[model samples]
Target: MKQTTFLLVFGVVLSFCQAQSETGGEETGGEEEHVELFTTPATKMGAATSDFGYNLFRALASRESATNIFLAPITVSAVLTQLSMGGSEQAERQLYRALRYHTLQDPQLHTTLKDLLASVKAPGKGLSTAARIYLARRLRLKQDFFSLVEQQYGVRPKALLGGNRDMKEINDWVSQETGGKVQRFLAKALPRNSAVNTVSAAYFKGKWVTRFSQSGVMENFQVDGGSPVRISMMQQDNYPVKMGADSDLSCTIAQIQMQDDISMFIFLPDDVTSNMTLLEESLTAEFVQDLSMTLLPAQVSLTLPTLKLSYSTDLLPLLNDLGLAEWLETPDLEKISGQAATLSSVNHKVVMETAPEGNQYPSATSTTSHLSYRVDRPFLYLIRDEASGALLFIGRVVNPKDLSI
Candidate 1:
């Protein structure tokens, strides 16, 4: 249960970070500025959150018979949006000012990520001291945010917002910002009358560079390790594939090239179940970087399952398993002192899709959206490092029968 909790929280954080990074290139100004106001810093948070987030994503993705799993990336975005919307221009400036300094404290969030990767079963070749230090900096930044949250909202959030009852208002603001995804998680984990406020948000969009033909779509896809569900499976033949030889663990990574150098890496577990622990152990940032460097285009057939899933998670036990027990147990108010508050707990929800839209196509084509990679069975998936093409981490939903509550 502890491990599960750690993994769940980790997944949500990682997903949120990755999704935020996807929008890095967009131009901001006008309505884009408003979204930018919300997205820009959120994207930075992605980089900040990626360290822990990707580690958890990879851990779950490496498991056997994992399928149809969804991880929420909304936590950071929700917090940021909540703060931005509920404050005055002065408050906004102060919040950003605090975040800037806070982020600087950690430098980079990927350090703990690299460390956690080292702890896994098939620990990949280790990272350089520089890389580890860089990641540590990021973790420190996250800690900084924790500190800011506490400082801004503590027992007297009114100091920041001008009243004693601002906590409920902040929570309400969060509920509206996230489209209702995070409010429940907050209500469950936080003290009902506590005046602390936080935010989390996540969004992702991916399209096959070369769209699969609906003419080739098939149904009743056997989702390898679980109950069979009718789904549209996308197939590509003779694509480039990479196979790796490691002691006790043979693995394959399938790259789905998207537009503008973006790609999704599909990691296939060598053994259906037995080697999961080894894969988890072996998964690491260095391994992913190395794997990205080694990929060569090859001719092969790719079959992908199409699915849509949304879910929420409670991550107390998960955070403890991951060595983040202090925040959960002691309520680290010091880190959040600048804001006048403390985080009781962090909760998250995620929604994901592996399907495409039908309206965009010609009327002559089938209206049903056909997406390749029907992940009906348990398998690992990752939105990863493209140039180095390293899979940050992969997630496996082995037992759809078991759900997060």
Candidate 2:
């Protein structure tokens, strides 16, 4: 079997940064204001996060499959990073390959994650990321490993007392962190063979600066060139949204602000102009870094669909497919504990929604409506932190009506 070569980049889970109050658009008081709050200073780590995330998404979301895939790569990467902190050299090496920790050279991986998490958890972002490892009772961890987790990732180990009861404990932790969006994470009972379980959960609630209209109208959504279905199409006419057509990726890109520091990038591919195969192959972390600069301000007669997506499960199969065989097998986690540990599971859960705030027009007084990005068909989207370029979530929405099914 050939080993999978992952094109590494780190679009951290829903974490990104730095528009210091520029202009959200023209102010109401006759000032030549812009909707941009402040200009963000880019960071290498942030770009890495996006690169890692996009690559991972393409790996999982194949066109032959359902083509509707959604996952928070940052949450998974952060959890893996936490585990790597206590893993053996071999395990660490595999993790470094998968998560691409080497991408961030200066501040280092942990420091970069700490800074990114801080931004995501800040007031009003409506995003949360958490990682935890549960050890069976009487299984003591090394003091140094515990200290490292505390100092670097700010997570503490929760005791697993019973089988079913302990699963509830993990479930409750995820539920609280995700604002009740997630419940009952672990389905099966804990195995005696495994002594450690690593889990990560992320939740983000982004309100578009220019909101979608609550009263959506029925419109045709082209599933492919052959199939077109009517769906509730959300509209925002004459909206000032960043727009562009990426000839390289063959997708119409649009950026909608969730907050000054956070925004979402939508990539809509056409039937002939876009090929998912080529698009997937070309999504590098470096490419995403230039997104902000690549897209220009345009007056959009935006037509989007009300979106509600939730995906949850273990990514072990996908990892195995990604050629992370050693990762799934028993690894010498001597640093974490004397007891042997195998990665029994690497679990993830994510949910996202784009509800309307009733056609929220930006504060801009007047501007030429030049371009448009209408999401009338299947497309891809990235929720990112604009300042730091950290990717919070990456997904492909093929059929909105059948996304969850």
Candidate 3:
């Protein structure tokens, strides 16, 4: 049996918060202080797309909380930036509609979020309403763009591209969607010498709404091994920081309140450098439940530094390391491709980070990422319910290298 390839390189690029010596400072406009969120449609139709989107977001959130690096606004902002940069108007519209539909279809998700939001301090009563409208509009625009792309390119551009002439058209479309930021990247990253036919892209960016000031100087912040690294620190005097402890590890959950009732929870491992493999291995639906029970309130001064980083990794090895072998080892990807063809392999590369901008007290983090999959061999992939472990989207990437420009 051929080895299956599925890779996921996920991590915080860089994070920084700026603050003065005091609490309650005026908001600044910069990269370090802004946070944005966006979503996309992975498949054209059916329950797969819907379920994948929801599960992806939930898994991301859960992971952040577990790692003590919860930054919801930044995560959302990063996703939106990618969509805006890489997605077509129709693709964007489809994403928006899907998110809205999900919210409506599952009222409990909304209710739970609303309850969480209600507990936070609202800067202005109308701010939540404005936030909702902003989100709605963003989703709508994305959905419309997705539809346009489908109509113009057809569902499978590779199938449409029978010859070299068709490749040019597909490339042109890819160039237009990425605003030229990624044309060359895609060209170089994708497998050129293969029987593959079609390709798709996803990009993301995000910033904080209330950015941190960069003026404070701090030294010797503890990392995993008690080695203090001098980092640019953002100080918050009074905010919500909570703590919990289990026999295996101590956990901290911090809520960075955003507009309305939405807050980002940061979960920091008590032992930052402890073999993360155990934590990753132990991650499951029940793990999330256990983490949620750990949520409580505390008041402390937050000292986070501004840092920016980016990386790309293949997800196949990582997925295999995590015990998902059937997809990579078997030849059953026909169900996903909707065709009776032998699959290639699936590989994903992602880049993301938060960086500081100015020398002043107020600063922000700007993050961006690009994820691409080149299925040169056959393998299986699935999108599942984060809460229930239910499979939503499953398919095989057999000829990713042969995909048209």
Candidate 4:
């Protein structure tokens, strides 16, 4: 099986050192200076959450060698963060470490997360993420925890109605949140004796800045240790892109612009035999942000595969492997309720689709060199938001035919 890693990073090209104040008019030097508070310095929060996402990705990759793994890091992180609000001191500390928030020591972490999520889910971004806490029926939540979660995460906790009914309701809600892209989110009823379950999901369908030609041709894509698979491959002539190479990782990096301050970065290894361990380990929110800034613009003959992929999984095992076994197995959510409450599961799902569509149609153009950028082999790719440097969706395609269905 081919070894590949995929990552989704959001919000690139912003300075995180100085924080942005809320939008308002401030009296300065007897003059009313009005500043639009459209954005906040949530980069620190984004970095912490993305670090957690990468950590989870590495854990999953270590277990599954060739399967396609896709997840929304922000959704998972946000759910965990919200749950921690109702946890005891020990649980809170454990979650903070899992989220890499202890390293930041920022008091306004929750607020920053709220603002970041709001921006990511804002209409017209081409991507959306949401998280919710589903407590077991008859488990009474504390007033403060309920209020804070609703105010910060913007959702009310739901009671698991039990049996097949619970499944239908949750699935319907998930479908509504994802614009009907994920109709059947849950295949079975909620876990028996489950006290709390965290649900997170993301949906994306981006338009390319430079659309690919509709005339795609079936081409051979080499899968490691397996026969080459034929798939529909889209192409564009003289596509404007930001390109770079990492000699240490032995991979070529290319960033293709998209609408709504989003960019897709592809990391294609030099050869099918190239080891992606180093590249995967080196991924961090800050590192990727720097790499995005350093990539130089160039026009290239680009060929990419059309993608429509969906992934859903239980994150309890991965979280356990990450040293949260004690917390997951115990009942220390006293702040949330006086009764014994243990985490039953963490459910996550993601769906992403992209084609040759863009603001304008593809066209032929002159180029300086024969810089052909063909993704005809196993490679890792991620969708990132340039405005805030947040990772949206990340995955690797060993064989395009695997998820095309």
Better of 3 and 4 by TM-score: 4
**Which candidate ranks first by TM-score, i.e. highest?**
4
Candidate 1 C-alpha lDDT tens digits along 1-405: 001101111122234334333343122222243333223332334343333455444434444124444453223322432343234454444433422323524333233223322222121211111000001111223344434434442211222232334435544544554344334423433344333433332323445555544423655534444455554566544333332223344445556665444456666654444235555555443344344433433333456655445454433334344443443343333333334333333344444445432222222422322222223344555564343322332345554334333
- TM-score per model over all chains: 0.52, 0.81, 0.42, 0.86
Which lDDT values do the candidates have, in the order given? 0.38, 0.66, 0.29, 0.75
Candidate 4, 1-405: lDDT as tens digits: 112222211123112111211111112311221111113447667777778888888787767666667777888988999899988899899989888888766778888888888787777777766578888867786777888888877787777778888889888888887788776777788877878998888888888878776536888888888888888888877677777667667788898999878899898988873246677777877667656645555667788887888888888889976778788778489888889898888998888888788886544544333577889888888887776777777876777788842
lDDT for each residue of candidate 2 in 1-405, tens digit (9 for 90 to 100): 111122111122101111211222212311211112212223565665666677678767763354577878878777777888877788877777777656445546677677877876687766776678776655566777878888887777665686777778888888887778766666676775556777877776677778654446888887764577777777765666665565555566777777657788887775522246666676655455445543446556678887777777676566665557776687677877887766666777787766676235645546534345568777777888766667888877777777541
> How does model 2 score by TM-score?
0.81
Task: Between candidates 3 and 4, name the one with more favorable lDDT.
Answer: 4
Cα lDDT of candidate 2 equals 0.66
Pick the winner on TM-score between candidates 2 and 4: 4
Error of 1 at 86 (Å): 18
RMSD of 3: 16.7
Q: How many residue pairs clash in each candidate?
A: 84, 28, 79, 17
Off by over 4 Å in 2: 1-42, 137-140, 187-192, 225-227, 272-275, 321-323, 358-360, 363-372
Cα error of candidate 4 at position 29, Å: 34
Tens digit of per-residue lDDT, candidate 3, span 1-405: 111111111112111111220121222221112111011121111122333333343344234332321111212222222232223344333443433333224423323333222322134211111010011111113344344333432322223323444445544554454344223322333333322222333222223333444424555444443444454445543323332333343333343332222223343444434233433333332233233333333334455443332222222233233233433353232212322222222222222223322223322224222211111122222222222222222222222222222
